[model samples]
Target: MNILMALSQLEVTGAEVYATQVGNTLAQRGHKVFYVSDTLNSPHQGQYFKLRFNKRSLPRRVWHVFYLIYLIFRYKIQLVHAHSRASGWSAYVACRLTNTPMITTVHGRQPVHRSRKKFHALGYHAVAVCENIARQIVRDLGVAESQVSVLRNGVDSQVFKPLAANHGAKPVIQIIGRLTGPKGQLVYQLLEQCIDLAANQVQVISGSQIDPIFDKFKTKVKFCGYSANIRQTISQADLVIGAGRVAMEALMCQKPVFAVGEANAIGLISVDNLASAMASNFGDVADGGKTELDIDYPQLAKQLRSALKQPKVDEEVYQIITEQYSLEKMTQRLLELYQSAYVYTKKREIPIIMYHRVIHNDPSQHGVYGTYVTLERLEQHFQTIQRMGLSPITFQQLDEIGLDHRFDHGKRYIILTFDDGFKDNYDLLLPLLKKYQFKAMIYAVTGTDHNRWDVEHPSKPDQRFELMSPQQLRDIDRSGYVEIGGHTVNHPKLASLSHAEQQHEIAYNKAQLESLLERPLYSFAYPYGDHNEQTKRLAKQAGYTYTVATDSGPVALHEDLQQIRRIVMFPSTTKFGLWRKIKGNYTIKKAAKPQTKNLS
Candidate 1:
């Protein structure tokens, strides 16, 4: 999959660093990653485009939107992950214009206002870096809770693992951040009041130029400007002071962190206060009334004095980071979110459930193929669908509504398709459809009025069942609740036949079904779900707007109209199993198991 990481930053901030790390990890896993931002300081594996996404000028914002559109088409980007509000706005516009899917990661608290609430550009789904930001997004930005997820910043444990303890006479203290923001002021305050300059060796790792006011403490503090190897620099420190990703990386290295941020101060992280610290993203965000400017320097001095006295590594800190913030785990979750967002934006992956027969009594005598569900179970399934608020739609309805407007009616839809046009469908299923006010698509075999093909098969020679006659098919076709589709002349596997034979079976069946129903068939179902590329081509040539196969096809329905996938409703399938199969990622989970025969 091709992914674009979009950001708007003047310098390397935590958001930028996080995107870089995620992009590199995704690239290593064989996904093509592209980046667009104002500045990219970290090493990346994908192509980078330097765009001034930080600029909010009218013309610049317009240009960013158009440029992003071009990049998306140029790279065939499957998804876009915007990391900042400015970039998200432009990226969201571009994605809409191109019909592409995008997700935004809210790395920090956003400025909330009436306009922001009215037009929140957080993309199709929003990923918050911490729980505090997730709440803020849902509450202030007017984003739905269902669309927000809290995924904390992940650290590369392999590189940030604990190193040899610094065993010097003086404990080393490191302050990491850009030197022009609240962090820079915090550094100056710590040097002047919180830290005993004579007792500890201090180093400042910053990308910005050192402030001239720090020249007085020049002899006491060592200025190490912008080390690319942060892990190596962190290795020499007994105590690390910073917030957000900085605090996370430090904790991953088993070093105690004095967590202070642009929002508030969370004094020296310990297992006792770990939950509170994490809730505020280690003080990078404001979780309560206190702000960074409201810091009590005298009280902070006492905490610092105590921290320097006994700076020890905490095993629980490392364990938490390892379990909750591992790079691999974050990448996996992001991938799942990307697929879901893509399906949602495209709105083409409607669940098409396949059912063979609905029997009135026990199927123990003729359930060899596991294809029959009891009438009671069928009613239960319908009740579940109604309770879930899923609209049972036919292919005719879908065509009329159009793919883009599938979800516009404020209810999700699923296609209930019954194969083989069984007599039970006309007698047993039509009333349920009327009772539930639901619609279904039934595939009819034009050549026979009974299951002659299955009866003739050596494997199931005695499993004969009655198929709906032409009159029954016409009645259902005009019932306003069922759409009739062709299912070949004799229900033979098309893949095992010659090209001419396949065309005869597919085309002749369509002609026969049209003659009976007096309406053109819009869909075709491959018998036994057995179809190759040739069979799909034949079905298209026969003039089917859509075709379905069992258990094999792309997850996104629009990707291949001729071979759309369907979930088979087996006899033993429970309500939970039905729910799982109806989900968008069911194909992904199904593919992991061994291939099974298509009982249909």
Candidate 2:
């Protein structure tokens, strides 16, 4: 499938970066994904094309009209997927002339100026990143039920890991994103709300902007510039306060996040909820008719005051991030979405989830896999998605899902992939997937040394495990239910290996897996789910087309193809867990608040 993705701007933003990630992943999956950005010199792009679109010109449409046609011929694009409104309008024109399937993934609300309703009808399909936005596109924008679909923004759960959340005896809260533009004032808003709550218990931390306004709250506000250590910074927070998607990022760190309404990028906050959050009296009390309001500073203070009298840990949020929003589960959904899009004919991003070991009795083994989720919990996870009308698929069928097909069908779909075929995965988890009849990809690690460690024969002395045997792998592959990819012979960090060593690990494992499954194999999984410049070059040199990484963020078009990220779903989730995760309602509760710190 040939796909040409269009980007209106190249600023370091969520939308641009996300588009690149989607495009690259599509290319890796054997779909010819081409990216055309407003700026020709986009740092994150592949096979770039120049699309002449100047908003200033009266007949800016004139340049767009011709360029759209030109791009059709240039890329032989069967479909055009535009990221932003301006680009969507241009792509709509091209779709009209070329009669090609053009879709504008309506990431957010339609711009106030453009005749978005009309432009939306011009395209074959539309995608909204969140349910609130999707409902708005359908209700307010008047896009047809058939034309509009919900494809929420996803994150690679692993890349964004939970760090030590302790504050060295002082409470800390992390605020993310740039302080310029709409995000700048959020610090002040947060500070306003936290003033009484943070008086002495919390040290507010912002990773970027340092503004004079924050000086007023100097004792409580912390301004740290562009923290490279996201996990560490987020870990210290007793609470995570952020704007827009940063709220979700804070959630990924397993911290409870309270977002000021102005910071919510997707506009999911209902005006009423903001009013409730703003209501000063209730301190984290559950009003019977109204949902429990959790952000009231007085209520929070009461809770903190109560907590101070008891025993509590600082790393509490870490547990939630791993359980509900990990890269493993996220990637599982991503793979499902990709495969669904392959067959459905719409443009969207999907992540392939990666999980390490599943646990039995040994606490050490359980630690390696993080908290082990019970099988009953797994059943609830699958049941939640099933009830929601999302069809879970396996990784092998991903190749069969046609990208040109997702639109015409009313049903939305996704693929579930589990990386690093661990013993517990085969024993406990595979049964559930089989019960559900879902498909997934398993990147097997093969080699002389790898085969020696048997998972079934765990030694009492911290029993190290073994990779699945070639015969067992063949049995799994023969079922036609799973796709076997290489996970290198040894599970060392790919970035640490020499180029030649990396090639051998990748190439040799590919051949070994191919012989076991007797199938064409080309996909590669980074060992430790880690990849660097050297590792990526080695994968290409070794002939694998698709590679997955641990970077925690949603897949987008402009992202580098080989360096993709996924979510790691863990055991901490409850019955309502998968629902909130899938329906994109993680931070909808505390959608609005105020912040005092700024991070530039």
Candidate 3:
């Protein structure tokens, strides 16, 4: 297929380099490639279009409508891989004219919100960076699961070789990026990794005082000039660390590179394939039943840092994560994205979905803390959300979605959150969340005796699927969207527990959840809406930044991510009932029902 790459501008950036990199890779694969964009204003551009089709005065949407038609006819393009939402929608319009396929990659999940849903409806399939993104795309835009591909961009081992450390210099880490604007702030990790974490262990190299992001970390790390000759710098480094194109480049240079990312953010790199991950000890793959390439969650960077202390384990983990995302892997994945970009499909864009339970429907349970929403209702809910414009948003998106970024628009956006990990939650929930491209955050008990109300002896396995097992929870946690929030282990009445026990219940549960998820648990929800000032205090002590309560109202008003309230619609909440809550009206608006206990 003749592929046409589209972006607002071919500027020198990670995404741009990636597009250029992939274009270079694909070009070598013997495919006819063309480029179209706003301007060829990039660090490196051999040949591409001037894209002088300026649409000023016209509304952005209207310009896209007009450009969509022009690009289709101009290039006779069979496929369009839009780098930005602006380009993506325009590609959508072109797809209409030329019957081309269009695809969009949610690069930053930034607040572009350019409305990719139009492309989804018009033969557009979204290529998410990771599983979290796969689910997020579905949740955010009601996109069909099959159409949305979680195509993680891979690193090229051949090109980005592992670093050959000679043991002369302190360990070095390279963070290549601009130190200004939106992308600039990412280098702050240098402080956490270079200065703080590497205090006495390693030297950190990152964007410097030339950009504002360098001001804090100047004393800690060597300010490496922001340039493309990263190969030279990474070649002389002990550890090539960072995510995105940087990691790939480091790996291609044969340097052991560690990718620091949450379960969802760096969705592109996969630790599953050890052979292809960072080639440990200069391309020697780790060989052990317990693979060394494995890096657990919660403190992902911390885990890597600790592993770095253990060369054997550190090297293995590096090899796997690196190899998995090697340029070869990324190439295949990109090819798939490129293929999908031009291949028209009547698919759904992903959206955010909200879920209540994953178990059987119990009559006694109302909304909120009860297993009121059964698998049937849950499935109906997914179907209903699908019918509407809503799709599933990855739970991982929650991590990036603060003041910095927001949900995608135009397509639907759904937030799928499971209140109680009822036995059915795993049974009824997991498959569905996986099915509908939904990322669901499950709030389960971190304390012992934490579980669904074992209805009829619970009929659960040795481990309650209702409340996930450490391994299961960790697996879901690792999945990026299956966020594990504190539900009070042992289901204690927070108000009743003393400060010590309350602290233990909250903090201990978080630690336990962290153990399972392999990442520090950040969000929590009180049990039975029974948290008190003490409970809230304990929650904070336990490292929880956000806490959810049974605020029986739809989330219409702006919500505080931390201390945010929830309006649950359980089995008692019929579809009509939910409609009321979603409309900013309480479903059962009965004088703001009192908490089961004074959970305020």
Candidate 4:
């Protein structure tokens, strides 16, 4: 596939490094990778376009957009991937002009209020470098939860290979980035205060932009001007301290990294701190407070001096780099995003049936109306699904359909899901399901023997619904018609919990259910369909393959599997109401453009 990469500048920054690495990798894989940047210094082998983006004038920026359009037509660019904000605007315009798909990888925490609507209007999906940036885009930028994804910055392990043991007597500490930046200041302070303890010699390699601070540090450290080859410099270092791309590269080189980025300082990168370190983009853009930095010069120096003697986990660090932060993994996800980009712009109509209870509906037992469905009404709902010539598939099956695009044009697809895992699902719902020879997914609350979570509801304080027993869950598992998925153990509001609590709620329940069923569990349903990005991520990290949210809509091909959309089938919903949902007649404010491309 022919692709165009757009960035405002090819400056010596983390974002530029990421674009260069990804572009080069794609080119090597036989993709026709073209690049357009304000600066033409990227080391990647690509057909480059000279597009100056620094001009603040509107006419100049407009000219660049038109030039991008011309390049799109000239090179038959299938997709435009923008790396920076300026290029995002220009590429967005170009994509709109050509009706081509576009996506942007947000490199940092950018203040995006005025352009938020413009970003939505472009209908371009976003890639966040880390989870913090992902949240920033969703909450601060107002991008839809479905429209943003996290693709962490990756390094080429092959290019930045580990060297032989070089932790010699004289500890050589290296710092690489612009000297005027926060990284430079941090490095300066560290060496100035802790020089007697931390290092025998300190090396500072910075870009062409000279800072006056370099003169002040001349006596204390070596200020080597930027070299075209950075990995080589990293290879010679005993210890490396830098932010963002430099730290990742150092880790790939099997060197211990003291990660300090523009925003925060991550003291050390190790197995215990890996998750938090990466969340902050290795301290590059740590909007979330996850790092512990002893910025006190004397204490930092003492700590570094002590740490120098400790053995390094080079292999463990290398394993992490190859597994989670490799170029290949990043490229593969990017390809998937490119292929699925059309889903965001196009409306996909499908039906997802939501159920709470299949017992007899009594008016007095339910203060909240949607929680109970009569047995007869559920039977009618199943009959309607069958009569409408729709196929009932599990959540896993739904994901597979999206992946393979195996749709029957003559017949529609309907997803049947049961929440709370009530006792009636085993006693009443299973037989009807067997009668129809249909399959469904049941999200069980593993910690409880009953639906005690609802007792605290403001409106319905006395609703004490009984949940299915452990044996019943196993029974449903034994039956081929049901897929048992995870609902939280306590069914707490996931968003209200801390990250650690959220992880325990999700991962612990998955473990409990898998043990009970004696099988690998993949599907999950959020309790009350209430979850934030953190909750969804916890579910993914817990090894769930797909998750359903209570939001009313059809699942889009590009939607995050961790937060799949589902339309609720309440007790009050009639056959006609189900049909309208099946027909996608309900109003959802986010409208999609008419689809010109077919998934099937």
Q: What TM-score goes with each of the models?
A: 0.63, 0.45, 0.44, 0.57
**Candidate 3, residues 1-600: lDDT per residue as tens digits?**
456777764345555665666677766665556776676533333347645334433476566656656755665555677776656656666676666667666554423144545335324556655454455556656676766665555555555555455465444545455555433443454354433444343444433335555566566566655455667666665555565556556655556555543211221233443323322212111222222233334455554555345322245555655655655666665554443232113222122223454555554434333445667766776666666655455434545553112221233354556655555566556777778866666787754434444432335423233355566666666665577777766766678778888777777777777776667776787776676767767777677776766652213212233344555665656666554444322422433321211000
**Order of quality (lDDT):** 1, 4, 2, 3
Lowest lDDT 10-residue stretch of candidate 3: 591-600
**Alpha carbon lDDT of each predicted model:** 0.84, 0.55, 0.53, 0.75
lDDT of 4 at 476: 87
Ranking the candidates on TM-score from highest down gives 1, 4, 2, 3
The weakest ten consecutive residues by lDDT in model 1 span: 591-600
Model 4, range 194-297, lDDT digits (tens) per residue? 65633466788876465676576677678787768898787677778777778787787777887767666666678787777887788767664332333666
Better of 2 and 3 by lDDT: 2
Q: Write the per-residue lDDT of candidate 2 for residues 1-600, one digit (tens) a residue.
A: 567778776343446545665665555555677777676432343577766554737488678767878877876776777777777777777777776766666554454335655556436556655455555666666766655555544445655655444555554545565555445664565457533544445444433446676677666555566554556667666665454445556555545555453313211122234333212111121222222222445443344334333223234343533443343443334444333333233233443445555555455555443535566666777787678777665434444564333322344555455666655666766677788876667778775433233333355323455456667778776665666777888666667778788778888888878877877775677866677778888787777665677643224311344665555567776657556544522322212211211100
Candidate 1 residue pairs in backbone clash: none
Candidate 4 Cα errors over 4 Å, as ranges: 112-123, 167-169, 197-199, 288-295, 342-600
lDDT of 3: 0.53
lDDT of 2: 0.55
Between candidates 1 and 3, the TM-score winner: 1
Residue 38's lDDT in candidate 3 = 73
